[model samples]
Target: MDDAVRLESLAKSYGSGDSAVTALRDIQVSLPKGSFTAVMGPSGSGKSTLLQCAAALDRPSSGRVLIDGTDIAGLSETQLTEFRRESTGFVFQAFNLLPSLTAEQNVALPVRLAGRKPDRRTVQQALAQVGLEKKAGSRPSQLSGGQQQRVAIARALVTRPAVLFADEPTGALDLTTGRELLEVLRKLVDSPADDGLTTVVMVTHDPNVASFADRVLFLADGSLVGELISPTSEAVAARMTELAVPTC
Candidate 1:
């Protein structure tokens, strides 16, 4: 499969002197199209930094980030904005929904912001995929946390982005609700409708959350320390224990 994301010697640092802190060091990783990967790390291990850098939400102090073979670092601000709009989707711990907008409107917002007219049918289908078609007209305040999160997922997928970056997507939900959200996300990654063009990368410290990924990348002290394929919560927890890192 083609690479959906490529990071070459990615580095990020804060401050400029003897006290400088490196959040990422010579990081390199890849995510292939239609694959699902999760990143795990301890507090301050650069998990969030890595996700931000990979998604172009933050620039690395050095190195490169490529999406679909196009180097995002080389793009100008306008071009980068376009690139993100056309190629990337993000789901954060917070629902990030507009309280004033209905679920359907929230899902359609991205396409609308891209200066294209919204396709009502496509928007409806996206919501349906998340089992929220019936609630499409409900406002964020009208839905439960899980239902709201599902709307966020729909918003992320509605754009049909090349890659989706989720940061602790289930962090804010109860176990049952989180599992339901994970199921929706897992289905989206494995969906034939993705057409071999979409990939998923999530940043999570929870082994249960990471268990859903096809692969788990472990980071410690700003570097990739290990990787586990076909990961399970048990396996990830064991590895975290071995690494002396606390498991969630």
Candidate 2:
């Protein structure tokens, strides 16, 4: 499919009856293959909800989510688990690395859990993609926060997933380290190699972080309010400022 992810008439809600609260509403968007897109919103804007649904981490209460042109709504929970493991990759604010495992082991954890042999060279290549090839033997305890996050990225991309969804990936790092991480992500999307990682959808509050993406989507109150192409930090920040103001 030309679109890596497509959400059609999507909606999500919690509870039921009059007490129900909707987290996403009539969301429709298509993420083109090999493109980087960022999602931004004020608190309760459902930016995270959109990411989770699009990634198949959570099923929408209504509508359809298509990944690589296949509808996932019909998959059973058991099937969904396997589909996610095989088709998607994720990174988050927390590194979620196993403390006892070395970098290489951590990167290969997903494959190993899937009952497959962990390929040493493939794991190494994942680390090299994140510039952590030399630290493959290091444990999470031995690595800095940035290094740990890099290892997490390696782990996420090890399967060569069609898409990567990151939620505040740089939230825990220092400014310099965060930018370095962003560059790593940027490089992956811009890589010249065919069959390499090229699609990314990140959710973040930092305007600077959002600017690295080819486009930025803005959400407010569970709906997409606007989007910016070729976004700049100044422009993103200003839009965020406007989003923050309460409207009558």
Candidate 3:
């Protein structure tokens, strides 16, 4: 599979000179198309930084962020905005839906924002992909938390973007609901025919959530520290424990 996202010697620092605090340091990694990768780390280890940079939500201080082979480091603000909208999708801990909009309207938002008329059939298909077709008329207030999140996922998927960046997607849901959401995510990546060109990069602290991914990328002290392939919850938890301890 081709690479959907690549970060080359990426570095992000806040402030300047003597007061500078680096949040990401020489990070280099590639996520191939259709892969689901979970990023795990301690509170200050740059997990959020990595996702923000990779997804073009923020620029890096130095190095490159390549999305689908296009280097975004030099893109103008307007160019970056258009590129991001056309090529990438994002989901956050907060559903961030318009409370006034129903599920079908919410799913059609990206298309509408891109200056195209929202297609009712497209909206229905997107909601159906997330198993929410029957709830298409429900407003955010009317849906359960998991149902709301499913709507958010549908919004992300409707764009048919090359990559999906999810930051703590299930953070607000209960365990069972979170697992159900993860299962939905897993099915998306698992089905190459439907989502073969899409890649998923998610920031999650829970080992059980990470286990749903194809691999787990561990970050520490603003660096790419370790990786686990075909991870299970037990293995992911063990790796997290190892990263927490200071080594001599």
Candidate 4:
């Protein structure tokens, strides 16, 4: 499919009956394949809800989510699990690396958990992609915060997933490290070899972080309010300011 992810009439709610609260509303969007897109919104703007539904990490209360052209809403529980494991990659604010495992082991954890012996070459290539090949033998304890996050990114990319979902991936790092990580992500999306096979979708609150993306989707009050193409930090910050102000 031309779109890596498509959401149609998507909505999400928590609780039910009189106390129900909707987190998303009639969301319709498509992420172009092999492109880098960033999602931005204020607190309670449904950014997190959108990511969870799009990644198949959680089900939407209504509507459909298509990943690689397959409707995830209709998949059985077991099938959904398999589809997610096989089609998606995720990175988050927390590194979430196992403390006892070396970098290589951590990167290969997903494959191993899927009941396959970790492929040596695959592990090596993943680590190398994130420039961590030399530290493959080191445990999380031995790495800096940036290194740990790189390992996390490596793990996410190992499976060659159709899309990589990053939520506040640079939230825990220092400015320099965050920039470095963003560059790594940018290169991944811009590289011709990867561009044909993988797409990247990231959610962040930082204007600077969002600037790296080719396009940025802005959400407010559980709905898409605007979008920015070829965004810059200044532009993003200004748009965020505009979003925060209530419309009469």
Candidate 5:
């Protein structure tokens, strides 16, 4: 499989000398196109930092980050902005939708921000994929937690980005709702509609949530400690317990 993202000996640190703290330590990982991956770790393990660095939201103090064979470290700030805008999609625990905009409008915002006109048909299709077609006219306050999250997912996918980085995307929803959302994300990554190019990288502490991924990476103290492919909730939970890692 082709690599959508590659990180080699990546490191991030803060402060200097005695006050120095390392957030990520010589991390190396690769995400293949169309694969769904989960990052699991205890608090302070640098899972979030890894995601931020991989997504270009934060820079590493050393090493390399590549997206589609292009080293992100070589891009200027303006070029990085363009790269992120055109190649990455983000979903956070918070819906982050504009309160005044309807679901459809929020989903269309990215395309508009890129100086392109919104295509109504594309917006509708994206919303429909997440089963939010009927609520397309609803504002964030008008929808339930799950509905709002679905809208967020729709927004992330509308631009057809090469990679989707979701930080605890299902954190705010109930079990059934979170499961539904995971299914939607799984289908989005695995289905052919994305042209076999949309890679998914999610940070999650829930074993059930991690079960939805093709692979689960375990981190300890800012370094990768283990990996599980074709994981199950029970199996992952057992491993987490063995490692004394807390779950969400």
Candidate 6:
């Protein structure tokens, strides 16, 4: 399968000389198109750093980041901004929704920010993808945490990005709500319409959340240590235990 994103000899550091602290070192991994991948590690393991570099949110100190076959490491600020605006989506732990705006309006913000008039139909469809079509008129404060996150997901998908980067997406939800949200994400990967297949790379500390992915990649001290295909919650937890890593 073709890679949605590929990291080659990627390394990121905080400073120079003796004060320098490396967050990622020689990380090499390829996330396939239309696949769901979970990244797991203990605290300060650089999982979020990996997501940022892969999504082009931050530049790596060295090496290359290829997204959908283009080398992003060399793109200029203007070009990179255009590329990210058109091709990538992000969902962080916080909903990042504007409390004053209705869900539909919030989803439309991305398109509007791109200097384009958002198509009402397209925004509604995006919300429908997350099963929040009917709640389009509700504001973030009027909805539950899960619904707000769903709105965030819709906002991310509104641009029809080739890749979606989610950082601890279910971290703020209860067990049932988180599981429901996971199911929504899983279905999107498994079944996409209009060739809207989206490759998902998510960072999470929960075994159950990792189990929702097609594969789980384990990281330790900014290095890829291991991986598991068709992972289950029990198996994932066992491996984390072997690594002596705390889930939280």
Clashes of each: 0, 0, 0, 0, 0, 0
Error of 3 at 143 (Å): 0.7
Compared with the true structure, all predictions reach lDDT values of: 0.90, 0.93, 0.92, 0.92, 0.90, 0.92
| Residue range with the least summed lDDT across 10 consecutive positions in model 6 | 239-248
- The TM-scores, one per candidate, come to 0.95, 0.98, 0.97, 0.97, 0.95, 0.96
Q: Per-residue CA lDDT of candidate 4, range 1-248, in tens? A: 69999999999999999999999999999999878999999999999899989999999999999999999978999999888887899999999999999999999999988888888888888888788999999999999999999999989988878889999999999999999999888888877343256688999999999999999999998998889999999999999999888889
lDDT string for model 6 (105-222, tens) is: 9999999999999999999999998999999999998999999999999999999998988999999999999999999899889988475687889999999999999999998888
Question: What tens-digit string does per-residue lDDT give for candidate 3 at 82-195?
Answer: 999889999999999999999999889999999999878777877887789999999999999999999998898887888989999999999999999999888888863354
Give the C-alpha miss distance for residue 149 in model 1, angstroms.
0.7
Give the winner by TM-score: 5 or 6.
Answer: 6
Candidate 1, residues 51-169, lDDT tens digits: the string is 99999888899999998888888888998988888789899999999999999999999999999999998899889878999998999999999999999988988877888899999
lDDT of 5 by residue, 1-248 (tens): 38989999999998999999999999999999889999998888899999999999888999999987779999999999888987888999999999999999999999999899999988998898788999999999999998999999889888777889999999999999888899898888766463446689999999999999999999888999899999999999988887684447
Runs off by more than 4 Å, candidate 5: 194-196, 245-248
lDDT of 2 by residue, 1-248 (tens): 69999999999999999999999999999999888999999999999999999999999999999998879998999998888887888999999999999999999999999999998988998899899999999999999999999999999888888888999999999999999999999999898234654689999999999999999999999999999999999999999999999999
lDDT of 3: 0.92
How many clashing pairs does model 6 include? Answer: 0
| Highest-TM-score candidate | 2
Off by over 4 Å in 6: 245-248
Candidate 1, which segments miss by more than 4 Å at Cα? 194-196, 245-248
